[model samples]
Target: MRLGAIADDVTGACDLAGRVAEAGLPTTVLLPAPPAPGHPSPTTEHHEDVFAGGDDASACAVVALKVRTAPVGQAVDEATAAAQLLLDAGASLLYQKYCSTFDSTPAGNIGPIADALVALAGADGTVGTPATPGARRTQYEGILFADGVPLAESPMRDHPLTPMRDSSVVRLLAAQTAAPVSLVPWEAVQRGAAEVASAIGAGHTLVDALTEGDLDVIAAAILSAPRPVVAAGGAGVGTALARAAVAASGQRVDISRSQLPEVPVTGRLLLAGSASAATRAQTAAFAGERHTLDPLALATDDRALDRLRDALAARADHREPVLIGSAPEVARAQAELGAERAAALIEGALAELAAFAVHELGYSHLLVAGGETSGAVTARLGVQRLLVGQQVAPGVPWAVARSGEREIALLLKSGNFGGPGLFTDAWEVAP
Candidate 1:
């Protein structure tokens, strides 16, 4: 594999994988194997041959892990194993993909996990940024900006899991890792890769990137640095990495796997579990039959699951697309059942609903929003890997995965990604 990406979440993995695929490199999203006998994380030895059935050399392999909100020690161990998996798969470049918003608590899964990957690669240092210009997320002067406003003042500050109250990337990362955190100013970056490389030292350096041009420069510098190239950033970096790899190796994207394939859009079902403003807007703008999941009802009532199943059955009978998600009153549910419990309840319920829509109802196309929810649904459906396909939005795509004997088309979207019309417009563009 040319690029081995370790994403902190499932949607983020698909986001990065899609970017790589767009750059002419076939990409695969691999989920970690089931946990060992009594272990919580899968080891490198245990995950061998994970890429055996997928694209080998000249392709990108991304290991998606649901460790974005996991505890520190556990997150580090799991991310490190994924790093080892990519390295063992003969990936010369290792990219750590996280949310474009740099979602994390003061006690991080990002900082510590990046540190683990760095140590494992035995690299002198690394350059990192979360500037995905396509998503309107950029970094300048070491501060992260979303849609022209600082991240602290954005909607992400109200995020239930990892409320990003600080806009300074240097400070956010420095608070979680002992390594010296520094910045490579836009002045240096604009001068080209050599200037950026010269500013990079023996620690984590944050680079400024406000546009695609800046990303290409940064990617070039990272790829030409030295052996075992290790870098960390959002999906923007993944796109740049693929372009750089192709330029250096002269490998072309496998055309057969890059484009959308002919697939039936019958039995379409849209399941969303994110409380993000984008998803709420999408749910409201959707012009179709829909059902709202009530966390409180699901937690306390026995008939809630039955009602949801029945709703799916009705949708299946008509072969119509439906949007099913929890109400936007997550705070109220969290207040009553605690944050973790409420999240688990919703994720579990959505996973079960996805299984029913597929296995029981014969749904062929599944559109899922949110990271944890996508992870749960994929796990419940027993999907081991996903082949990157046509994109529906900036970071969301329609990929194919197998569950038993069924070929299911999945469109996994991050909560903060896509437009308000996504839930409705996605169907019009499906292959």
Candidate 2:
């Protein structure tokens, strides 16, 4: 059994899963949700059942965990608890979700967790982390062993984040174990997938030709290959990507979304107007209806923002997905409106979405309109990134960036590209 685990925050989970599936590996992911301290441990029985159904249960499973920023104490505890559970479950390989925000400080949150996991898994264990110094705007040296050996390290160059830095420590640790190491960059993964597909079409070793960010392309390349394909990642994005991978491979593949069901809605409602216009529309759109709220609305000053928050207090309430248009402009306006006001609008929107997901909608799926909106929304939600843009086989967009945990999938078109289809592609909508 070649088991692989991806430990990361929510956004990273999706990105990694998409890449892994692209690599043509059967994979599973353990995603993070808001902590439920009093609740009993969720069941893994279903996962086991599913794995057993596979030809080689032991050989096929890969688990990825997305780590979130928690109180230093709680983060350590959660990591330890998760590691113990994986060990008990006989997980073959484990990867820790590392980030500058949580793991960069001297007394960082993930170090303790990684140490604990190493102790638990011994030689079989691997710790992985992403280098994200730019997004966090802070710096710290990698941890050292008692014998003066550095744990693990990987560079964060070309990652789609601001003032980029390296997330090499965890990768270094994983490499030390000589376990199958994966370096995940939001754009690299997708691009790599494309390249691998081209290579496979030309003839190459499935493993030898594999490189960082080649998962998606490799999976696509191996569509006709003899090996079984597995796609997995965090809940929402993972589910979508896995679906795409399965469709692309023309094969039956196993995948899972977040256990938390999302609030359902009807009508592809598009929220338009200025930031304020969209904000005003969001309140009315979801007032009493049961629908998913788009996290991007947080970037605007919508009048309904407050009302939506109030409505989401009850478990039965659900709001419609609020799409925020012209997000880059809105963000700029908000900045001019002063950080406090800007944050308030964004915060209000996020609070509404969170409440609705946890209570009313049960964590529903929502899509943002633009890359900027996707970035802003996910950032406010404490997610590092959200996979934006749709893939039409081999068509590559003009711009793409991967921030710390966030990824902005942008599809840009020139004014002269095409009169009508340009707008459609920009919005990732079918023409």
Candidate 3:
């Protein structure tokens, strides 16, 4: 594998994998596998031959993990193992994919995991920039901006898990790793790729990217540097990495996966659990029959689950697209039932609803919006891996996974991704 990616969440993995596929390098996002004792290390080739079965698979693989908010020690161990396996797969480059806003607590999985991966790779240092301009997240002068506003002042402050209350990436990472946090501003990056190489050679574990151009600089420098350096960030970074790989090699490898079949307008079910403003807006502006389940009602009412299933089933019978979600009042429910309990209730309920929709309601396509929600739904459906297909939109794809004897289509979207018409426009022809 030429490029091996490790994403902190399922949506983020799909986002990165889609970006890689768009760049002409066939990529597969594998579900997390337990690091079993005495088991042969899972390589990119082995995973593609087994889970990602199809035509000749490319040399890029993305592994998605649910360790975004796990305990620090556990996160570190798993990341180290992932890095070792990717290296074993013969990938010359490793990218740690996270949220565009660099979502993590002061006591972090980001910093600690970076430390472990870097130590395992025996690299000079790891770069830090989650600037996915497609998602409206950028960094300049060491501060992260979300839609032109500081992250702390954005809607993410209300996030239930790993609320980003800080805008300075350097400060946030400093508290988690002992490595010296350095900033490579846009000015230095614009000077040329050589400056970026100099910074990495001198040991700058963290850098800054203000726009798409800056990502090019970082990628070029890393790919041509004297010593190997690990690239880290969101889908934007993956784009630049693809460009750098092609530029350095002076060619694009052949890939066989064709565009997905035309997406049918009906028999589609949208399930959203993200509480972010983007998701809330998309949910409210849904063009299909919308049913917003109240968490309180879902938790207290004995028949709430059955009622939701019946409502979705009715839509299926009529051949109409449906949007069923519990995203209206997450904070209120969290306040009533506590954060952990409320989140668990919502995730569990949505996973159950999705299972019924796919197997019993006969929905062919499933759309999920959120990280924890996707993890729960995929786990409940017993999907061990996913076969990537064409793009539904930027950072969104129409992938297929096996559930029993059926192959179900899916689109997993991150909280901050997609525009206002995302829910409605998702049914449009694949790009």
For lDDT, candidate 1 versus 2, the one ahead is: 1
Superposed by TM-score, candidate 3 places the C-alpha of residue 225 at a distance from the truth, in angstroms, of 2.4
Q: Model 3: per-residue lDDT, tens digit, 353-410?
A: 9889778866677889988888888877867677676666678876777767767778
Q: Kindly indicate the candidate among 1 and 3 with the higher TM-score.
A: 1
Better of 1 and 2 by TM-score: 1
TM-score: model 3 vs. ground truth? 0.90
What lDDT is reached at residue 382 by model 1?
81
Best by TM-score: 1
lDDT of 3: 0.76
Q: Which ten residues in a row have the lowest lDDT in candidate 2?
A: 201-210
lDDT of 2 by residue, 357-421 (tens): 43343433343322223233444444321222232221112222232332223222111112222
Position 401, candidate 1: lDDT: 83
Steric clash pairs (candidate 3): none
Q: Give me the displacement of residue 162 in model 3, in angstroms.
A: 1.8
User: Candidate 2: global Cα-lDDT?
Assistant: 0.34
What are the RMSDs of all candidates, in order? 2.1, 13.7, 3.2
Ranking by lDDT: 1, 3, 2
